[model samples]
Target: MSAEVRELVRTYLPEFPIQYCKSLVTDTTQFMSIDYGHVIELGDVHYMVYKNEAERRFGLEDPKYWVKRCHELETGKRKILKLEFFETFPVQVGKFRVECYRSPDKESRILDIVRGDSRFMQGITIKDAAGRNVRVLEIVNGRRLDLTVDRIDVEHDVYFREHLPGLLRRYLEAVRAIGMLHRHGERHGDIRRDHLYVEHGTGNLCWIDFDYTFHSYEHPFGLDLFGLGNILVFLVGKANITVQSLEGMGLAERLEGRLSSDDLSIVIPNRIVNLRKIYPYVPEALNRVLMHFSNSAEVFYTTTDELLADLEPCVEALESEYGRKPE
Candidate 1:
């Protein structure tokens, strides 16, 4: 994949330097995902964001977050720089305004918990020239879970039967990794599908971007639990099938008429929560677990332990029905 990406880069920028080409091996994510552009001077080295075909084709550094793809010139090492981005997002989760904070200090502790664990990104915080802390993480080269699901060629039914069962079982390792964090009194407040990557070398499903956290909360790990639920939905369905997407599937009117706002994801309103209604073949156990997030639920999951307790059996059943678990 790295070779293919570099080959595409060469086709785009024939005059691109060889050194720059080497840097792209680690920094292949579309430039739209970051606050890219210009050479940044941190304390010890300069951080330059790599250019790619998307950047050349669309010509957009359509930057969002303060993350940047960079190389340590002094070391010629690939690194991801999370440069001083902090946000306190106040979300109303029933009675609580779950304040999500993106802090480097908070993330450092999460990193500590997963230290020497291949299932998470490893990084250290360093104070820059003016004394602001900048997170410097080694660029993990691999496939994002979202991209991996997208690339699967089979239909959802085929994917669910042949592929998803194995992934669902493997996904528990990641689920439990978060459980370990929660047990240690920490939460990965930002648990988007893209934040997870399967590493090229280890094939470990590694979690990245832990800086977003809510310090004090009425509901501990509310965001993290919800985020995990969303990922589960994606995996269970083989891809995220929103209420809007159902129209294209020719099931829109039939399913939409039956759905209420309660049936939608509590966190993301348009995302379908009761997936089994659309894809009836979804295991009853898994569907029931997913339905917990809908507005129809009486009890909500507050811990990964509880989530895993219910989830483990459903996956075990899937493995039983689908064949042996992946070795």
Candidate 2:
């Protein structure tokens, strides 16, 4: 399948080198549902082009829905149906706001939350060269911030120490971004370390991946806080505290056997063990922050503001103690 995808891409884009090809799958379902086309990467740009007969064979609608909607506004009824089939590529307006799904409803919901926020990536609709309506978002040129840290040779203690302050600053900024979302009564339903990015050249921190985000009016704020704490753990520990690791440490089995059904008590202890094993040099102040939020204490932060207040001083203390002097 991958070979076929590569060949198809070569036929269409002969000028560009096919860096890689992956079987594109739809996320709207729990079970894996392969899409009609493969997501191909040529140099730095990526495209999702379907095969010639894919639309017919798969009964897929036009991926470019906004294009037709523009025509509707000009001639026919302006009332666009809220159907799921119209969403296609990332419509490039002023910036690049890529919608991963075909549902306009999801795009509208996400835009309503993050459209104007500087901390979050922004998006807008625009007309393409074919006079079709499309959406675009501000492109983040850098790789995931965690990837940068992960690439660092941890054995070179001096290198790790030199970069620690900058990593800490980015971490704090990420926490603040999440806090801003919470302040607006929203929750970043997915808060993994990969979702936070450090912009290339500018070193600006921004959050991405709002596909799972939703209003948090009635939801507990602890999920985001806990996620933030885990991110901090990843930073200070210098390694991911994954579920597989927890299970290896026998923490998962213990939690399953001992913990109550509703109790969210298993995260912190497992994190502490992993942190100690992989990155025991994690500072006391930062360690406390991770512990406080992930522990089973009832007094976990109710607002990101509270978490930020506690985290800022810790950041300062770490920088003062171990930060390298600027060149």
RMSD (CA, Å), each prediction: 7.4, 12.4
Best by TM-score: 1
User: How many angstroms is residue 214 displaced in model 2 relative to the true structure, after the best TM-score fit?
Assistant: 5.5
**137-250, model 1: which lDDT tens digit per residue?**
887788888788888898888888888877877688999999888889888888988888877765568898888887445567877888898899888887677777888889
lDDT of each: 0.73, 0.51
- Model 1 lDDT-worst window of ten: 51-60
Q: Score residue 87 of candidate 2 by CA lDDT.
A: 26
**Candidate 1: RMSD to truth:** 7.4
User: Would you list the clashing residue pairs of candidate 1?
Assistant: none
**Alpha-carbon runs more than 4 Å astray in model 1:** 1-62, 325-327
Per-residue C-alpha lDDT of model 2 across residues 241-270, encoded as one tens digit per residue: 554565775667654454331222234343
